[model samples]
Target: MSLVKESREELNLIPQVMHSLINACVGMFASAYHQAENKKQNLLRTDILTEQFKRLLLRHIRTHKSTSDYAESLNISPAYLNEAVKLTTGFTVGFWIQQATITEAKRLLYTTDTTVKEIAYLLGFTDHAYFSRYFSNAAGHSPTEFRLTHRK
Candidate 1:
């Protein structure tokens, strides 16, 4: 019966307090895990969409250059496709499409003896001048300059 000593009732209540604390800790951990899982799922879905877009671009690049065209083929809205691309690549849909087109143009320039006008037409560019401007803007030089510098 010392003042410092705990009674049987107090000792019984100590286990109850510990159990509540453990439950609270578990609940917090569970909530944190759930949030992390949701973020991972969102990232996975964005990555899948980005991969699909890239495959479609590579296969039908000459025919389908517009963001809306690619999005429509993929059964998604253009805005959503853009959002997913931005999330995965930190670039807009138009930027990716433009880059893909330029990459193909460069490949054709380097690998084939095709003239700039013919290459532009092959890439579905209606105007060779517009293609030249676009190439200069993106590649920092005209297609001729790129071909000369890269030619073996």
Candidate 2:
């Protein structure tokens, strides 16, 4: 009789225990899914910021040459801007700025009849000599040399 009573109690507890385990597993899965969603949202936000930064840099590259200027415009810290840009593009803000400047300088040198000094001034350089040095360092040739080689 006692054995029969104990068996009945054990049988009643089994379904409750199983239900508790199922609830626990469902909770864990839900938590994990939310976390993954949050991570995806964060990544999307960072990507948007990076794209905006690039656009701002291109638009204002001649007038604003520093990362801090873009950062200020975006209302973010310079360090955060650099980190996001680097994470998305595998390069720093300064690298992109230098590349843009050099590419524009090369374009001006190759296409127009603008003198090197005038080109330098147009690109916001205060001194043409420093611009020539900067162009040579990034482009592997001075502005005049590049023009002579690339021009017909």
Candidate 3:
């Protein structure tokens, strides 16, 4: 009887978790589409486009880290992407990608018990050492150190 109850609880939990995940995914897609539309509504609105790009980049940085990839997704030329991002934000698209990657890495480090290598991989980094260097360059500390200092 106790085993049956436990099985029921486990089964209920799975659907709840799946429901939450599905909702989150739907929210993310909605946000991305909204950002893309804002960019399209005004070609001269480079600042708005750049801001929208940042939102999109933050949501998809793990999968789309390259400027050219983002450009292609937006149906724009790489040079145009770079120009708009730089003109409005004073930073290139690559810079935004690096910043977004580093931000996500920090969030994962502080929020999860993942190892540095795992966090690097989670952030779409191909090489752990390269991630370490990148983090150190932008964050002023290594991933392990940042995790240790910021962990609550």
Give lDDT per model, in order.
Answer: 0.93, 0.92, 0.88
lDDT of 1 by residue, 10-87 (tens): 888999999999999999999999999988777777799999999999898888878899999989999999999999
TM-score of 1: 0.70
Residue 141's lDDT in candidate 2:
88
**Candidate 1 local lDDT, residue 18:** 100
lDDT of 1 at 77: 96
State the RMSD for candidate 3. 16.7
In candidate 1, which residue ranges exceed 4 Å CA deviation? Answer: 1-43
TM-score of each: 0.70, 0.71, 0.67
**Higher-TM-score candidate among 1 and 3?**
1
Rank by lDDT (best first): 1, 2, 3
lDDT of 3 by residue, 1-152 (tens): 99999999999899899999999999999999999997777667577667778788977888887888888877788888899999987889998898889888989998889999998888888999999999999999999999888874
How far residue 63's Cα lies from its native spot in candidate 2, in Å, is 0.5
Quality of model 2 by C-alpha lDDT: 0.92
Query: Backbone collision count in every prediction?
Result: 0, 0, 0
Off by over 4 Å in 3: 1-45
Q: Which pairs clash in the backbone of model 3?
A: none
